[model samples]
Target: LEPLWLVGHTFAENTVGRLMERPPAVFATGASVGSVIEALREIVKQRMVTYVFVIEPAGRLVGVVAFRELVFADPNQTLDQIMLREPFSLRPQQPFVDAMREVVKRHYPVYPVCDDAGHLLGVVKGQTLFEQQAFEISAQAGSMVGVEKEERLATPWSRSFRFRHPWLLINLLTVFLAAAVVGFFESTINQLVVLATFLPVLAGQCGNLGAQSLAVTLRGMTLGELRGMSKLRLVGKEAWLGLLNGLVTGVVAGVGMYFASRGQTVADPVWLGAVTTAAMALCCALSGIAGATIPIVMRRMGADPATASGIFLSTITDISSMGVFLGLAALLLA
Candidate 1:
């Protein structure tokens, strides 16, 4: 029941050993159902008992007997007669995150922790396992935007500043890349001022598309759902999604562009609209690919996938959207 913080352990750094509690109900292989029930009468007084573990003389976990099974079984039956053999277990030294992945689908109220030799060491409450993981998952959004996972609301201003300032500098550098793309198209913007009005629109839409892909990719990775799936396939799927979404949104944006520039005489409004439509679709597709790819690449490099992924994604989407939008305007209209 001790809080992880009190022991200077973060969720990510914890192992099953740190979270394990002494097993509440354990019996040798030959223990009878009546005797186990008798033992549980006193066991329940001190702590909760969900499952009865059957262990060998060497303390190796042999099987598990649920309480319901015990209640219905013949009182003379030995544990070996009713216990489920080769039950799943968690190793004490296994990382909490790994254990979480292993147990996510089991939904057991408690899990037995054992050594490499399968000797029963202790038990970990399912609630404790999930609570730690939930905390880690909750911090992912902050990590995506350059906030350190360790920075809590109670963190001092100075420490928060130190945690956040470096990423802001990196963000500034990326902003300049986007700015340079715009600067590269400076003449195009000057000639067609309407394009300037829609620059934010394109960037905003593509950035949003990229964020969607990023969020899904990170979630899949966290939940271990990405296993057995090809990373290339994931990126391709996101790109396809982006293309479809962009096509739909782009038409609306194109119509808006057509109306916004109707009063202007610099270029044909129809062609301008087409340029917007094309740029939006192309940039969104690219943004989706970038979004999915960035995190995968980061993970391959041994960096946390959620760490500043949003910042990197924003830079990519901004550059692609603006560069494509203005480049298209210049090519087709100018």
Candidate 2:
């Protein structure tokens, strides 16, 4: 703890403590700035404290309320009046990996940890957090790059890369699976080039719909706001949405295609029309499945559904959409 910087409330007052080797100092005034810097000087005189944190009146994270901000605020003002509101905070029970991510994203020297209701718990500085991660914990949490907790004063660039690559690899595998679906339908694609033209449009629309539902669900999950057994109810709602959207999109695309290409001697014009309608419906249905199932499954498996496996979802949508469209095309036009 000697080498580590401990703050009563802010960073500036502690310089004297480093020089004189003394006890830590605390904020004398409730004012946000003058008190914090004054407190910093005291910490330095005492030599035990290198930082100071300013807590708001109600213990909510108003701001880190740094010396810089304090300097700007009125010296006579209380912290409640001068303190910045809605500062980013962390949860005590959060995985260090998650903490690391927030720290890196915010580029903060320290992040405050709090309970669910916004009560202050402790502060984790960027350097110390990195140093505290043991080798085993780091390994079990996967690579320690972006969000993985780094417990050391300085984390190497290469070490950060280790954590990021695994997710990239997972993304690549999901891409390949999607590509495999396209490859499986090479014959159907060859027979009906026109169907291929609309394959993407149908699949893409459904994929988007499903993704919307997934996003709402996941957000609800994260906030602990999705109470009761309403998850299935929510999924059913999206399914109904898919049906409506599918009907509209299919009819519109089918009519547009038929009228736009009326000049061409299109084989099975009626069949083509029917195919478009069916493909849209199927695409929407499958999209809902991919959207709803993936997140639910990820959650059940104790994985972050928000790691955005959109690529995997897209892959599923593409394959399913293509398979349905081409299979129908073959039977109708063969």
Candidate 3:
């Protein structure tokens, strides 16, 4: 082992080496096609076969021959002449992200894992590499919304309570902040009872918009697509989306509420309806920023971006939405 680094070094847990399966079919390059056929027979009898790796005397990978290629080849043909030379391989130390990129490009069913010096270690199934992480990526959606991925449908009640309650308390505190905003506009609510009617409607819109952005942001993070992307660009993109979406939805909501408020006794119904439109646009735009920014900041600080992001986003959206809605109503009507 003159170059001991390849043989002895430990890869980080998520690297291709840890997840790779034991080599299904492997033989020395010196073996004849007949001997390779016998080896395949024995190997297939013991386990499923995919590809046969051809290695050298020192166990360095030289080439590969797929099961179909070997089955169709003439038994008289030597492995040296038959095996495809210098096949694609992942080094044991390669990061999972790098391996995934390679897998995407090659679209191979199984890939060989090797050392830096090209000694074959094992092979990784494309499905095994992706399926495990697929669970992780999908589970992240629930985790963002304060649901623990590990908390199964059969999870004990006590465990469920323990998982959800802490964030629930944090959420409760945020609700009070929104409540306090309402308390600040107490006089206005008393004067114009109709403003209270659309309160839930406006809050719901902001909360939902924030959630939509949060889900998209988390998906980008999971795919490693956000790394090369500028943070400002992500923020800008969401902001513009929120603006356009908010403007259209807000106008509709405002008009709808205006009709609903016609019979209510208010000093200035028109001004109150105008406030709803303004608050909707403002809250939604701010929520989009909060949703996008929270996850990015969480990742930057080495925290799981998905951890309770929905709770935080909701809290922020609630406070801003209520504050703008109520503050505007007070200024206009009371």
Question: Evaluated with lDDT, which candidate comes out highest?
Answer: 1
Error of 1 at 235 (Å): 3.5
Candidate 2, 1-334: lDDT as tens digits: 1222233433232121111221233232254455556657756664534334444445544444555655677766766565545667666556655555456557665566555676555565656555543432433223211244342337676876675666667767766776677677777667656666776677778778877766666656544566575777777777777777888898988886566435545356776787778788768866776676776777678976655546667677777777787777777756
What TM-score does candidate 2 get on C-alpha atoms? Answer: 0.54
lDDT, candidate 3, 121-184, per-residue tens: 7788888867756656767867876777677789999999999888788878878888888888
Query: Which stretches of model 3 miss by more than 4 angstroms?
Result: 1-18, 71-80, 91-101, 115-117, 187-193, 220-234, 256-266, 300-302
Better of 1 and 2 by lDDT: 1
lDDT (CA) per prediction: 0.89, 0.60, 0.80
Q: In terms of lDDT, which candidate is stronger, 2 or 3?
A: 3
Model 3, 170: alpha-carbon shift in Å?
3.5
Task: Give each model a TM-score.
Answer: 0.82, 0.54, 0.79
Cα-based lDDT at residue 184, candidate 1 = 95
Question: Residue 155 in model 1: shift from native, Å?
Answer: 4.8
RMSD of 1: 4.5
lDDT (Cα, 0-100) at 291 in candidate 2 = 73
**Candidate 1 Cα outliers beyond 4 Å, as residue runs:** 1-12, 32-35, 72-78, 150-160, 222-225, 229-234, 259-269, 299-303, 332-334
Lowest lDDT 10-mer window, candidate 1?
A: 1-10
Whole-model lDDT for model 1 versus the true structure? 0.89
